[model samples]
Target chain A: MIRLRAKISSSRGQSTNISHKVGTWSFSAFVILLLTVIFFPGLFAPYDPLELDVINRLQAPSKAHLFGTDEGGRDIFSRVLYGTKDSVGASMVIVLMASGTGTILGAIAGWFGGRIDFYLMRMVDVFLSFPYLVLAMALAASLGRDMRSAILALILVWWPSYARMVRGQVLSIKERLFIRAARTVGASNFQILFWHIIPHTYRTVGVRASMDVGYVLISLTGLSFLGLGAQNPSPEWGLMISNARSYVLASWWYSVFPGIAILLVVSLFIYAADRFSGAER
Target chain B: MAQLLQILDVNKTFKSGNSKVKACQEINLTIGEGEVVGLVGESGSGKSTLANLVLGLEKLDSGSIKFEGVELEKLLKDKSKSFRREVQAVFQHPLLSLDSRKTIAWSIAEPLVINKIGNSASRKARVLELLAAVALDEGTASKYPSQLSGGQLQRVNIARALALEPKLIICDEPVSALDVSVQAQIVNLFLDIQKRLGVAMLFISHDLAVVRHISDRIAVMYAGKIMEIGDTDDICESPIHPYTQALLSASTFTEESDEGREKLKLFRREEVPQKGCPFSTRCPHAIALCREEEIKIQSFASNQESSCLRAQEIFPNLAKK
Candidate 1:
């Protein structure tokens, strides 16, 4: 556990800013409860995600199925509920993998410089030259239309941005005295990077990761919508949207609810990122 | 005297495309054991470059440096950990010198932990002991560097430097960033540590008065070359080199005010030449020979040396002035 010393005290502007935002119960509750809704969907949802009812097809909100049923007689409410878990889980994994790989590689490059910095930055440039969507599609197409391929593609495309962010932070941070001080104390390269530089970079990394959650979620949904992710009948929200888009001309509820779920989750991530970054500054 | 530290004819020049930028000239100095050698010069005087070279942070273009009997270059050639363990550095900015993420306890213990000197329990104990030695409370060990004052942070830096039990501590303007009162406290701490440990110190500063107080010997540097080197009292009372005398006259001494302000100026303050004497442009007494010829170290008064063409001629004029 990192024992954080609140150096900028209550009297400081940062503390006041943190206090002002934290006092709003709605925002705080949304952030905390949103995680629970994503992680433990079964406890929160009224119906089983996979359950279907032919009789309730195209029906609006009622006592039995609050969100009504889709064109194929599947419950819109249950699928959206379960979709939260899968969507968040996949995006979280993508972010963790990308950020982890990127930060490590970036730290090595920035701290070592010379050949390491030159090579790693060039690699990032190569990846960045391709459009993210095109690269993800290409990867998903080649690897077969599976959830894993889509995730792998997204991670591959996403890592370069993190690498760039981390490298920028590292360049400035490595020049700091603590790193030199670490060297003066006979600290090995590994120890200095992990123990000294990483923690300093993490503040910016944390904010970036929080903000990237929205982007990752959008990318995952886009892939699923393109039929390159989460196979049909999986109760994934993006697949539900893809399957429901035709019926939206008649039964509007089919597409609207899932879209709202996506919006709320994305908005929450963006808002949370804003708050976290604000507090840090 | 048996040399504790010796830097011989070191020259370093940086390259930019076709041209070269001379950062340090052919410099030589020998400091003895248990002595505080003041490396005094203004900003961009190559004082820091020389310090960095001695610490093995930067490679010397030519010449060699030795600490005791061991060659500094040879020591740095293989394992620098031992070199760091023997010769530590305290940087200019105390705030920057410490890890903000770590607690004071952890930062101080880092050196001990890195060197693998004593196990976990003993290291923790040692950190607390060091904190106390620096006149800080044990409670401060758990606090981060940002929580402490500037003076407190510098003391922590000093404590960290001494943790490796280094033979020499290269303090690069360690007290310049602090309040004048705090400067005294830290300087006194250096003196106290030197008295207790008998550690040779390469005390680098632009402040002549502070250097005079702590140093046994002084070396005045300009544009990376040592203009004069002698015992502290000898250099202060009767400076042989023109640059050294000009520097002394300008500074406000503890005993007297800037009484000779009119005479306390040097004119050779142009951009340091690519080669030859860096102070030549500023030297009011520079002759035609000063421009073409690089001044070499010439013996003068007892245990004193001046790097000037007209050291003998300038000595009487400097004393009379």
Candidate 2:
């Protein structure tokens, strides 16, 4: 810990500022570029992702079609660029839901304790007992395969971990003397939980939420990859990859680019989350 | 002068497993307006438990605490929140008592904000005023608790307690966790605040010297019972209860030579006899009756009493206030 602080101080004393470091700039640039592609896919792609050209099926990379075309003759590159929206968007939504629900439950459970904590934490434990992907797949199968079902299943399988994390954080903080003093000062339980209590858990929750975003992306993509996500022709990255399975040997461009797209976006989030957590100490 | 607070036969008991621990047993005390009553005891002597009871942070198992004839629970039931604003507490641990994530300004302004004392502009003004009152610099308000020293954090804690202009403050070992130098400064600050604001206080501490310097009257406890209660000087010079005599003698042994040490021999603990005097197992003057019969509090002077059955026999010449 002392060494890290000394290294940070010495680096600042020298010429290389933290933001100007190569690793920081490159990671930041990659994130910014992914965001651009999500919000402005039209700007990046000349060809429409859904515009089918069955005539040019199984074509590899060329000048006119950089990532070539899928078996449906849809342009792979434009679709991959467009599919950035769901992979990033769904993960963010799931994280926000998980963190929000988890924090509230955890705060109440930890603060009030006794029976509320007992039942709530037990339920969380039950949800957590299952491996996340298996649970997500089971829920998707039961709820019927669609984007909304996939999201619902993911949120159900995910919120318990966040609830469990924030609950643990809140448990530690509620024991602080200020919380008891706050109660004495006539701050209602609501005010004490939110103002004096929950904010203390934010740093940990931020780190956890960042890490969860990556896991959510992976789970959603894996579900879609197994034909449980947005059905064919929607250009969602996972569905796109699933559609390319038959032509894998003939047209490696089809599965590989979309696969890289998923891998790149997931790592970007994980890296950001890792750095976010490291700075908290 | 009005009696500001009254704790009448207040009882609190905790069940550990099969047996019960009487945290506070039939405690009776009163504080006049602007009076500082120091309740001193060892770690398991229930001083903190009594502080919690008076603060209404814990529920009393059997008896009642009242402020100006209104019961504590009734005061809490009303929606006005006047009772809450009127009572505030400063805890022992400095850093633990202030929210680490919040700026000092926000912490000091907490009670005012919770009670809705004024609009944002006026609240900020009061926060600044309190910061000055606690002897903190204006720039200190912007910093988090971690950025400040223990003494600085404690000053902020005091400022927060003082924000509502509370009528009674419960200070639970507020300076025990501070340095010896900082302890004097904070104690003096507390005395100064009490003089200026005329807020009554229930100061709980295990330090006899700190209690003696600031308390108008002192109550000494042993095993969840008040062993001695009287005017500060009267009790210090001639403590009626053997427990108080042992305490005063113990403090003297720390500073003086071995000359007066044998006057009060410290008692060793035995099993707490549930039906008799709580101190019977440890009292040097204990008779068979003391171990078998319940000991009731005997009053001596104006508003002073002790639970020891031997109070009159031991200190017959003790002067009345």
Candidate 3:
């Protein structure tokens, strides 16, 4: 009976391992396909994203137009494919810049502590007290209606969370005995910060940065949807959705495809971050 | 012998809200060149605080710590690199003393790197030599702290401490965290290193037996004050202070007569007196004078000193035993 039970448990473990492998392979494939879409939209796009065919305007999904045509008779599939760069690429840049700035500021604050920590943390608090979207909207509006302004606004508002997190990590890590050991071995403050303290925060910062990509994408598109980002004719995901709103009742395929594109890409990034964080544990 | 490190009337107090704990007070001690002075105390005895003070990790409130005729504060401010290179430390937890992310070779080479002593090739060679000195194999250098056993990690810590050929090394309970079996090996390794390198050491631990094995002299501390200090043989055989006598009688390795054990009571947790000896509250032979008068360490003909006022009368009886 014991032997039979052992065999059953071993088979169950094998099945779970196989399923895990399958999940990992498919996730990798999806990421590769998304990357290709962002970098070379011309490869899979059947029609010129900007070319118009007014005679077939508002056409539903058909053989010639896989995702049908917008009110301008532009191919929804091609537009969504091209919009990947402006939406997802912009989000990636924003996450990287914010995390980089935050890591440096937080490391300095936590390492020096005292008045420096107090002042820097107060600055972070000032940014954090405001509602993220409201602050981003105000900053975006003041900078004028463009994707660059929207991205800059998001970066300013997003960095404080990273700074706060990295600071917390540094506070705990600085107390570790190895840091004291480093000091006894003649390491200066700067050397200790860079070599001893900062390296320990990388795994945490990397996980947070990956997770922030999805949120930044949603915020960037929200700005575009509100007419404060990407202007018109830019093929940005949120601008495409905003344009399709007028004809949504008559032509559902136009907005639905782009919306699905946003959902799929956002979920993919979040899932990847989850897997990365889990892999270490 | 030339004095290597002198700590005179040093004091440190930690204040949090309304309570104040004196971690070190009027602590006078000296380590000579190529000397091993064991500082043994129970938990909360402030031996670690003194180690931190000598390592320049904490500021002294009153007294001066002179290392080779230079004030500690001046050495730290003007020639910190040289000062740090001359004095290194081995902490209690070996794994905690090493950077977990770095390999053993990198950890050992860190001091050399900071001081810019040699190129990467020479540093690597030095790391190998250090590993062999600690009885660790060459392959141990490539492994991380987590991959090795506690004893191996301690060997790595010792190797790192020895990388700069420091003149003095402060060991803060370096072997207290290891297994009982492994503790002997590490203690022996410290003895071997001291014999070969002739580096001065201030070894701190609560275990008297371990300290006696490796220390040339012994100092017993209680409540941030040294109760007695002398040659290891003098302390073990004729401890004048009631506190030191209790410590020696309590150690498991020492075969004490049942009558001697009965004479010394187990240490009780009593509030330390503010004006008198710190151990007077729990002393087996404390008189009114012990609690009322400010007691100082009294010297004896045997080259030992004790803080107990009655140590002169106590010593002859202890000698007869």
Q: What are the per-residue Cα lDDT tens digits for candidate 1 across A1-281?
A: 22333554735876666555673444468657767877888886887777667776888767777787886677788788888767877888898899999999988888899998999999999999999889999998898898989999999999988888888888999887778778767788899889998888887887788778788998898899999999977877788889887888888888889898889888888887777666666
How would you encode candidate 3's per-residue C-alpha lDDT over B1-321 as one tens digit per residue? Answer: 999999999999989999999999989999999999999999999999999999999998999999999999999997547999999999999999888889989999999999999999999999999999999899998888988999999999999999999999999999999999999999999999999999999999999999999999999999999899999999998888889988887787677556656446755788788988788888778788888888787777678888888886766643311
Where does candidate 3 chain A have its weakest 10-residue lDDT segment?
A15-24
Cα miss at B174, model 1 (Å)?
0.8
What is the DockQ (computed on Cα atoms) for candidate 2?
0.77
Clashing pairs in 1: B267-B282, B268-B281, B268-B282, B268-B283, B269-B282
Q: How high is the TM-score of chain A in each model? A: 0.90, 0.88, 0.88
> Is candidate 2 or 3 superior in lDDT?
3
Q: Candidate 1's error at B68, in angstroms?
A: 3.5
User: Across residues A150-258, which tens digit of lDDT does each residue of candidate 2 receive?
Assistant: 9889989888877788778888887778889788888998999889778888878877887777888888988998978778777888888888888888889999998
Native A-B contacts reproduced, model 2: 0.92
Q: Which CAPRI level is candidate 1?
A: medium
Query: iRMS of every model, one decimal?
Result: 1.1, 0.9, 0.6
Off by over 4 Å in 2: A1-33, A53-56, A118-135, A138-145, A271-281, B252-263, B319-321
What is candidate 2's TM-score for chain A?
0.88
Interface RMSD of 3: 0.6
Query: What are the candidates' individual DockQ scores?
Result: 0.67, 0.77, 0.78
Instruction: Give lDDT: candidate 3, residue A192.
Output: 94
RMSD of 3: 3.6
